[model samples]
Target: MTATLPFTPPLALASLSGEADADWARAGAEYAGAAFLGGIALDADSRAAARELVDRDRTEFLPDDPLAFIDRELEALAETPIQPAFNVRSATVDPVVDAARVCRDREAYLEINAHCRQDELCAVGCGETLLRDGERLARYVDRAAATGATVGVKVRAEVPGVDLPDLARGLESAGADFVHVDAMDSESVIADVVDATDLFVIANNGVRGGETVREYVDYGADAVSVGRPSDNPVVLERVRDAVARQLGLEASG
Candidate 1:
C-alpha cells in the first residue's frame, strides 16, 4: 500500500501487555530508538470489563486510574527521539475521546484496539467484539479520528467469517489513518488489504527478524510491527537496520 503519511521507520514495536510494569515496559520500548506501540492502554471509561472480566491468559490490563496510567506512560516516553504510538480500547466514545485528545496534544498515534480477543472485553462490546459490529466499529473509528490524533485501528486478520477486505474498507471509509493487521500466518492478506483500501496498511504477526520485516514490507504493507522480540536490543536493532535499508533511513545518523 502507498503510505498515506510518510514514516521513516517502517518497523515499529507492538503493544506488550502481560508485562510486570507497563510504563517501564514502554520506556524500555522507547529506549530502543525504533518506533513504539504501547500495549492496550484502556481508557478511564473502559472499566465495563471489570464486572465479568476474568483475567484469562493474563493479558488483560485494567488500570486503577487509566488516565493517570496513560499520563504516566506518555510522560515517561516524552524524551523518545522517534515519534511513538499508543493503543486505546474502550467500549464508549467519551473515554476514547479523552485518550485520543491527549494523544493529539502529545503528537502520538492513538490506535483503537479492535485486536484484543479477551472474552472480558467482548462482554463489554469492546476489543475484538467490535469486529462483530462493523457499523459501530466504524463509528467508533470516526469519533477517534475527529480528535485529530493519528488514528489507527488494529484488527486480527483471521477472525472467523469476518470479511477482511470489507472491514478494511469500512475502517478507511470511516477515516482510519491506517489499519494495523495481525495477519496471522499469511502475508497475502496484506496485499489484499492494500488493494482494498487507500488507508495505510501495517502488517503484523510472526515477525521474528529483519528478514521477516522485509518479507512483510515486500508483501505490500506500508509498515511492519514486532512484539516480544522488541524486548531484545540486539533484535530490535537488527530489525531497525533492515527497515532503514528498506525505507532508506540511516541507522547511526
Candidate 2:
C-alpha cells in the first residue's frame, strides 16, 4: 500500500543547502503543505564533505552536533501547521538512523539525500553517489525507516546508468514513505517512477505556475515541491494557486 503524507494540498518547499532552515520553512509555510529543512551533514565523513563544499564557496550546514541541531530546528516548528521535514546527507547509515530517531521524536519527516550532484558530496559516498548505489541508498532508507520516522529519498533525473524507476521500487521495498524526484530534464520519467512503486511521488524542478503544477499532477505525482524559488513568495503563491486549481482544492488566488 502507498503511504500518504500527513499534510495536504500536496505542495512542499525543497531543501536549499544553508538556506533551508526553520525560518525559511516558516516563510513558505502558508503556501506549502510540507517544508524540507536542510541538506544537513549528519556524520564525520559527510561533515568533511560539507566543509569541502564550503571551501568551494558552496553552502552547507556543518553543525557542531548534528542531532542537537536537528532537534532544535525541528522543535522550533512544533507549533506550526505545516509539516516539518529534514533533508539530510550522511556517508554512513548509523548517523541517518540516529537522525531519524530525532525526527520521529519530533514528529517530523526525514528525507535521505540522493539528489545532490556536487563532486565533494559524491566522493564521500553522500548525495548523488547514492543514486548510482541503489543498494546502499536502500540500506539508508531501511535503517532510517526502522526508527519509525516517515522517510523518503530525494532523487535527481538524467544521471547516467541510474534507473530511477528501479531505484524507486527498491526504496519502496526498503520502506520509504515517498520519493521526491527532481525531474531535471526528464519530466516523462516521473510517470515511470510513479508506476514502478507505491511510494508517494513528489515531483520537483521548475514548479512555478499552473502549467508545471498541472503537468506533474497529470503525470501522477502525489505532490510537487519548489526548490531554489521556494523562498520567493510570488513564486510560492503561483505554485500554491496552481496546486489548488490542479488538485481541485479551493483556489488560493
Candidate 3:
C-alpha cells in the first residue's frame, strides 16, 4: 500500500551533486519541498576507493574524512528551509551510525546509497555492491536507524538476479523509513516495491516533468525524483508547477 508524507509539496529535488554548487542553497530555493543532495562517501576507505575511479556523471572529489565533508555540505544548506536529505555510504555501518548521531537533532535524513554502480565503489563493497548482500544491507540499515536520525535506503531497481521485491521488504523490516528506487525503465518495479513494503517509496529515473511526477505518485510512490531536468532552472520550475497542479498543492519558491 502507498503512504503519504506529513506534507507533499509540488516539487521534490532528486539528489544531485555534480550540478549543485558548494552550498545547495539554490537547489533548496528551487523548491520548498524535499532536496536530496549529495551521494557522499562516509569513510576513508570508501572515499579512497571512489577516488581511484574516473569521474563519470558523478562528482570525483573525495575527502579524507567524508563524514566531515558531508557535514560541512549539510551545514551549508542547513538553513534552507526545505526537507533536507543526504545520500551517503560506506562498506560497513560505523560511518552511517556516526552520521546519524551527528545529524540526529538536525531533522535531516541520512540515506544509505545502494544505488551507485561505480566499479571502484562496487570493488569496496559499497554502492550497489550492497545489493548483492541483502543480509549485510539489512544490518547496515538497522545500525543507521539505531542512531535515531531518519534513515532512507536508495537502491537500484535493475540489478541483475536481485529480487527487488524481497529487498524492499527486507529494508522495511530493517527499519528504513524510506525505500528509494531508481526504477530505470521499469515503472512496474515501483509498484512491486510498494506491494512489498510499507515504507515510503521514492521513484526515480527519467522523471522529466510534472506528468512523470504524477505518474509515479499514481503508481503508489510516496515521492518522485528527477535528475537531468533538475539542472535546468526553467524546466525545473515548470515541472514543479506541474506537480503542484497535478497534486492539488500550492507551488512554492
- State which candidate has the highest TM-score: 2
Of models 2 and 3, which has the larger lDDT?
Answer: 2
Q: Give a tens-digit lDDT track for model 2, residues 1-253.
A: 1123856768999999999999998888888999999989998889998999899999888879999999999999988768899999999999999999999998888999998999888999988898899999999999999888899999999999999999999999999999999998789889999999888899999998999999999999989999999989999999998988898886432
lDDT by residue for model 3 (22-116), tens: 35535546653666667777777787776675344456546666667667766776666666667777887888888876556566777788888
| Model 2: lowest-lDDT 10 consecutive positions | 1-10
Candidate 3 overall lDDT versus native: 0.73
**Candidate-wise lDDT, in order:** 0.71, 0.90, 0.73
Candidate 2 TM-score over all chains jointly: 0.97
lDDT of 1 at 117: 86
Q: What's the lDDT for residue 165 in model 1?
A: 89
TM-score of model 3 vs. true structure: 0.89
Quick one: ranking by lDDT, best first?
Answer: 2, 3, 1
lDDT tens readout by residue for model 1, 1-253 = 1112545566667776544233534544532333435445464335656434434435545667776666666666677555566777788777777877777776777788888887777767777888778998888888878878778888998788788889989988888888889998867889888999988888888776677778887878887777777677677677767777776677542
Model 1 ranges off by over 4 Å: 1-4, 18-37, 40-60
Off by over 4 Å in 2: 1-6, 251-253
Q: How high is each candidate's TM-score?
A: 0.85, 0.97, 0.89
Which scores greater on TM-score, model 2 or model 3? 2
lDDT of 2: 0.90
TM-score of 1: 0.85
| Model 3 bad stretches (over 4 Å) | 1-7, 17-22, 54-58
